[model samples]
Target: MTDRDADAALDRAADEALALFADDRRSSGDRRESHVRRPQRASDVAETVRWNVADWAAADWGGPVPQDAHAADSVSNGASNSSASDSPADGSSKGSSFNDELFNSDPFSEAASADRPAPDDRSRQPDSSPEPNRPPEPNQTTEPDQPADVPNEAPEARAHATPWRAARTAAARAAQPLPSVVRPLGEALGQTLAEPLAALTDLPSFDTSAMDGWAVAGPGPWRLPSKDATPEGTGTSTRTSTGTGTGILAGHAEAAPLSDGDAVRIATGARVPPGATAVLRSEHGKVRGEGRELYASRHITQGQDIRPRGQECRRGDALLPAGALVTPVVLGLAAAAGYDELTVTSRPRVEVLVLGDELLRAGLPHDGRIRDALGPLLGPWLRALGADVVATRHVGDDPEALHTAVSASTADVVVTTGGTAAGPVDHVHPTLRRLGAEQLVDGVQVRPGHPMLLARLAPGRYLVGLPGNPLAAVSGLLTLAEPLLRTLSARPAPPPYRARLTEAVQGHPVDTRLIPVVYQHGDRACPLRFHGPAMLRGIAAADALAVVPPGGADQGAEAEILDLPWTADGIGISADTATGTITGTGGTP
Candidate 1:
């Protein structure tokens, strides 16, 4: 069959299907009213028309329908008016003996021609009727039965199971360009630094006294004769005199520059007088002779309890370089170093798109709907990873709506929480293709998030496709979101840790594994045995996600694991040493 023919058929089928469904709703409403009132016979005309149109639509483009190159140009006209009595459902039940004849002698069979035009033909206009509310059609083909919601399950899961590979692939595919370097410090909290930072000034720029004491000018071991000292002794006399006098004074009076034997008192932060090199505590000194005499119990060292100029840090030194994650401590240090502001990278903005028709915002399903947990689940997770969510929206399983939402977002990263499967309503993959996005990783080998897709829309712009399931969405966010953020920030991927598996883990032989687990010791993390992507309780209780090798291994086997670090500050392997576990020291075990 031609692409043109297929396109025409699809267009007609879609239009007819939409109209038929609308009429069906009207008929159904009429029947309900009839039941409420007196019993009345309702014409089945609308039902037959709805059934035929729906059946035709499902057969044309619903699930895995092979494309014909020529069907694309077959026709641009709308559906033709047919007699409502010719319902496809009636034909199936009453004409069972003629089923083969109808199937073999189908008039639309020739519609699958090879001379189809491209999908973007200006002559084609989409059917305007809104999608009908209907249950998914049951699989009627001869193909093997697969999970209705997730069809490409096993292979995609296996592809994304490797964290390192997935991380690298995601990073490579992330198109968000590195932002300009001149962003404000407030906005750069989570961004990577474009350049290194140097200290602007020396901490403690001037010599300051650490304690309130007399700044003396004399050699060590200078003797203060007890006979002439005050009752409080030499140290007390010195302290008292210095407190009273401006500098050093004579004859226990307030004056400047005391005589050799005279003592002056001083307060905390008071500058020491010239010729004074040591501080003797008042408690250790003795005073005698009506406060005229003072004596020291011990010798004092020079520069005692004094902060020298440029002690903590020197001017122009590299206090903190660019690309370093700024913590509160870092901010404090920078402030102390006399920097009013800093030049840092800018944090990437993200937009979360939740896609599905069966998903409900809240409450129980009145029809066949289910409450959506992806939005609530992913918003916090992305925020925890340091990505700023500028906006979040829920798009029902409509391809055009999904396209519009994604196209309108100016965020660096766009995450779609569902609609990645091949089901009729699964529109993410096709919508992305329509948007001119370059697919980096179409599918990964991993559990729960195998259908995840990573793509680049433009420079500094990324799109990550997540499965419709809540757990799958989370897994995709973790596996793909991490690297995408890093790439935008220009940060390197964190290294993996070689952890000893405390419990045996079973996994597919061909796929890499990601098992959510908890670390016991500070450095040595052991895998928590129980896990399920769909079960939020177990994942919530987990401390880390341990990566098991492709094949299953026994307990005590050392496997590379990615540390979730939800509660920790840094990433990388925790080094287990003989003394203590070391982390964030740039060492690996």
Candidate 2:
């Protein structure tokens, strides 16, 4: 190794040693072994790769070792793949192009080929890998923090990424819903009902007046009963009167039974008196002089203006089935059914790790750092998709820190933004390998978000890695996170819908394209500008995503639509009906 390479490697070791000493999580006795975790296979390590930091630094260690690509090529890559001395971190040849990545091949390796040349015989795959041997177009822009040369993933993973539909399915099937929880009504909003919503009591348990009116036995125009008469029942429905009735009030005890041909004044929601066969609405009835008698201004039918017992739901009846979404309306229904709390499927608790050393939390992009867009976008977006975001921590790009954060997480799902691509600082794949997590969806056959992935961290826990770009991350959110959260929350899948295209759209030769679109005249879907993976303008103003099939779609063709949640803070897509082009009001974000 060169002097510089030696110094860097030694520095890394010193840092690790310091961290081990400072670590409060581990026991002191556990540090008895040599900290240098080397590979078992002879070919896996070079003479230079092995270090003699005391006799305990043995050669046959069987564990993951995070290594730098330039330090020594003989050092094994984290995955099941070999490394080339001058090879790109990813196994793809230097000649691999971006077009081929989007078309005709699996694409888990997010190599930044466009930003820099692959080592003479190397490759790292990702969103910006340029077409081989071609100059970057004048309008082409590189993603932030993409250096001219960086170590990436092996080409092997890229060659076997899952397709879009299958990736979504695999994510949905990765884990089951968390255990049920009994949350109070205040906390159950947006949760899924774990059990059927059976009524604790009959809705409208007694025959009650539906309006301010008179409860009359037989027909009105009959003698008016004295208001002070005891509320004694003459029929099966009589309720005991609580006090002298000004009339029957809503919360008061039941009034005296009505004598045949007699009427008593009653308020809306008051229990109907016994012997009262029907209710005459106040406006429809009149009191004669001296108020001794009542007359029906309109025909009074039996049971009119009265809410019969159990009008809405009877006791023990299921008002809502299990898996029902608990919306505000549902909360009201539950309250009316006498539920102080509800049995709901526990929301999937998620911890978000925002990776990358070039991210700024609160400032203008400067000093080689860019503002973190995904950090703000994901929390609320995930909430809308039915997840409880427990924490959103900035984990940076250190492999060890990423590992520590991931391993220590108690959340049901750990979501990571950026570092998914096979770049030098891309520690997500390596960290996941260290944790023994299963990659359910390595990559996808979709544009802008092809590098997104889903993995199972443990039996009931999962992780979803999103691309670094803003728009690409959004695609992953809907494609992977949304489905996973929905399934884990026991929420029903939204019905798929399609819309006619207002204009023609180009499609990827093989991969599917998710384009932002807005509803147009005649319910057609209009594609928006600035729909690139890194751009967020189009999505901010979009009503839904138009799933354009491979090879493109013609104007007026029907395309599947994935609707976005409505937001008052969103911008609109204004269509130029004359030209068939769309301009979004959402400014660059």
Candidate 3:
């Protein structure tokens, strides 16, 4: 069924539920005003229910939720000015209150069931072809949808937060590779190849001995080059006085040419002389007449134990394709292929603006101030992600300072920590508006970091606003910044990795949740505890962030794995006992 059909159905169900709530109150009421807050539409009914579910379950109209980075704007928008009467004369006549009704029966159960289709229902399939201006359903899985379905650089698409996959796709498509640069091999690590790494010359470059014994020409029973005089039926001359030594060694001058029936000792990696056929290993050859003659203890054949020139690759052969990440092994290969300087995609320069006033730079939290974890956390983390973190400065909550910091940033990507929400002190949105930045992604439909946003400062330059909370900021890093930077650096996107969950993970009702998980028992991803948006304990020890879909994941359900930058080296930070600093990563995160 279509998204609108489902929403309309849910709206109808919500309307009915609201009507039931009113009717039940009236039938038993002795003319008491019903004071429960309600939603303006059915789509909001579920969110409203979620907002109050905790309060009603506790049988109390709790105080207002704190306005913070974690609290969604949608949740705080539905404020209530009225509540039920504290005392009623006819207690029995008042009947079950709304709380009791909610506890006894689910308010949105029918709507949820109607919205979700049966497992075997053919109509459950998502519409592959959506009309123009259509937004994807929350549960719909996308696969490189058309430009119309997924807006890359358009502002009209900002009406709704792009789906997680679509957001990544758009981010990657939004920027191009910065530019190619020729850097020495020493500085090329962690960069991407801007052009095909073709072999400058033949690998090995020359035929070399692959063994430590005789470099024999024309087969076995060859006479050896020795210092002793030639005995009867034996042979050769000393290689010492005439040359440097007997055997040819690696990184030395070329050996004299060998004629048929003559042999010379050679070391592994030593260049084989012209007319040499095969090399007999030291262990496989027998020395006769006190080393005057050489004989193969085992049969020797032509071209044995020899590395031919260009054995691995020929001149001008592509060693690695363009856009390949230059790793340590790649460095070795390039060096082997005769490359001293490489043309690689330059690392995208990132300037991190940490925004907060209450955050303490050092010392224990005192007088309502906490340590600044993100400042220490983001720099090296971004560096590990292949970004050249040029600078990380603490930009206070002052709007003017933030604008100045952002406007003056010459870095390719400007990452700001905190102040993305509509809180009284949140100034990110206002600054962006003042700067006329085109917001590509205002917010994501993901938990913990939904307030994160992406805006284009100019062509090929962008800004990513991250939440202040450590974990939420990490989520923003992975969600928006990662794809953008990866694309800008011309790094190939990692293959989609998935793992089956070892246990169930409760999910957000509407938004996607990134659960920090560790791999156990092979490929099973086990969820860790203390995964709240504000807490960094779980993610500090996580192997990857699992992309748990809406409505949660069941046991053994496969979820996409977003790898951590430090996952390869097992990046982990030991949280301080007092939550002040994580004793690793050279930072407090």
Candidate 4:
């Protein structure tokens, strides 16, 4: 069918579908009203409409609709709503872009044409003025490390401050006096080395054969003697019945020196004799004269297939510098270098306190109480970030209990979830004042976790307050705890890397937004949905957190990425197929 004919058929089908919803419609004259009315009984009209749209999209557009694309029905609804609003009182149709809009919007945004106008044409014009209360474009150029903008009518106390500066200040002030520990090699996987790894002895201490071969004294085509009639008391060594050279095993010690025309059958790694000039591989030599005699068939080159002493390293040579991470390969290398133990930086001890009266430890939400997601997640995450999580305590919103818990903890850092705000039930700030603690960071200019704070309780003790929301708490952990633990454990900061955003990220007008993103296999990053401050869906599946500036980042704009402690190394390469877990490396959510 022709394109125009197909458009007319679609319009007719949409009208029929709308007619079916007449019983649920509002009064006829409310042009701008678009929502379906509440039905007295359960109905399937919405489902029918969605299926119809999906069918039409597939058949007319020559593309299959993504089964999980929930936005398809919404696009159809928008077009229907536009048609309804454009209808005249006399029942005449007004020209509209409904068909054009529907045909152009692709379910996967990457496949959509940039030049194609949006369903709402106003969005396509850069010069179009935004609504007065609407946020500005996220790609606005801003100075480095500047605070995000505050709303014009916002109170002075609500000024959005720089988060990076706050993190730096907290880290600089977070110091611990714990002594280094000598740990067995097997126990030093995640720990940073406190001293250089030096070789105890020279590698390959003696000259050896590099391959299974014959150690020869000189030129080839040499003959071996027959064992026929030599005097029994003669001053000559015994030989094999075939008169081949005596075979030398790898660990044979006290091997006699070779004369100018002699050859010794030597294995790989076997020590060469004092007077041996070269080693000829087994494949290069031949036996002749039946079983009584043998001859070296190939010409011999001096010093071939011989491993000289101390080829890898000399005794006392430094192998690994201090502060190196003791990974599996490092462990093997240390063992080869004769180190039984490693001196590693001490892990900073941290105690966690989860505060909230309306939190349940397990099960689905009931009676307005939510499951305690942070309690189960934070401990392991902190350990992954190099903190020794000593204990985790769940204390309800009781100020006295909170105060006691904070006072009794002997850990280097106390991480408290919730109770940092100024609400009546939020007792963290007031309790800090009562205990005469100094607040290092009051608030950060980051979204979802802006209420996070850091305080110093004593010379070597610290308190970090994280927001109660599951995802917000994660932001706080990375923003405050990561740096603090890194400093306390004396681990060096990782080098910075940035990824170009594959899609535009909406930025807060004044606050830097820490967006949950998965690095695509293409090496760019794409933002995930469901990343609201209270939601954990995005962060749970993210490979890294994109540090968006106040104005946000545009498609293809480079943004700094904060790697997650557990999965950063395998971001785009690792896959957990059993559970179908995506590692934020461009996999689908």
RMSD each, Å: 21.4, 18.7, 13.5, 13.8
Residue 405 lDDT in candidate 1: 83
TM per candidate comes to: 0.60, 0.68, 0.70, 0.66
Q: For model 1, give the RMSD to the true fold.
A: 21.4
Candidate numbers sorted by TM-score from highest down? 3, 2, 4, 1
lDDT against the true structure, per candidate, is: 0.52, 0.66, 0.68, 0.64
Among all windows of 10 consecutive residues in model 1, the one with the lowest summed lDDT is: 32-41
Q: Which ten residues in a row have the lowest lDDT in candidate 2?
A: 54-63
lDDT of 1 by residue, 342-361 (tens): 76656567788777666666
Clashes of each: 72, 14, 0, 2
Model 4 agreement with the true structure over 1-589: per-residue lDDT tens digits: 9645554555455446644433222222111112221111112234335443332222122223333223434453443343323434212235534433222222233422243232223122342343545432232212212222222111332443346556655665567535789999877777788989999887877898998867778775544434453322223344544456346667657466777776666778888877788888877777676633335565667899998888988899999898887777889988877889999998788888888887776678888677878867877787777767777778877888888889988999999888776665788988899899987887787776777888899988999999887777898888888888878877778898999987766454456668778878757877765565566766777788888875556678899989888765321122213311111111111
Best by lDDT: 3
Instruction: Give candidate 1's TM-score.
Output: 0.60
lDDT of 3: 0.68
lDDT of 4 at 330: 85
Per-residue error for 205 in candidate 1, Å, reads 0.7
Ten-residue stretch with the least lDDT total in model 4: 579-588
Question: Residue by residue across 1-589, what tens digits does model 2's lDDT show?
Answer: 8645554565455445434322421232121112232322233233214221111111111011222322332332334333433455333577976532222111112231233222221112332433465543332223311111112444554466678878878878877888999999988888899999999998988999999877889965777644444445322232223221346778777677778898877778888988898988777877775565788888878888889999898999989999998888899999999999999999888888888777777769987678889877777777777777777778766888889889998989988988787777888898899999998888887776777889899999999999887888898987899889989999888788789987666554446778888787857888765566677876777788888775567778899998884431121122213312111111122
Please list the residue runs of candidate 2 whose C-alpha ends up more than 4 Å from where it truly belongs after superposition: 1-154, 226-245, 566-589
The reply for model 3, stretches above 4 Å from the true place, is: 1-159, 228-245, 568-589
What is candidate 4's local distance difference test score? 0.64
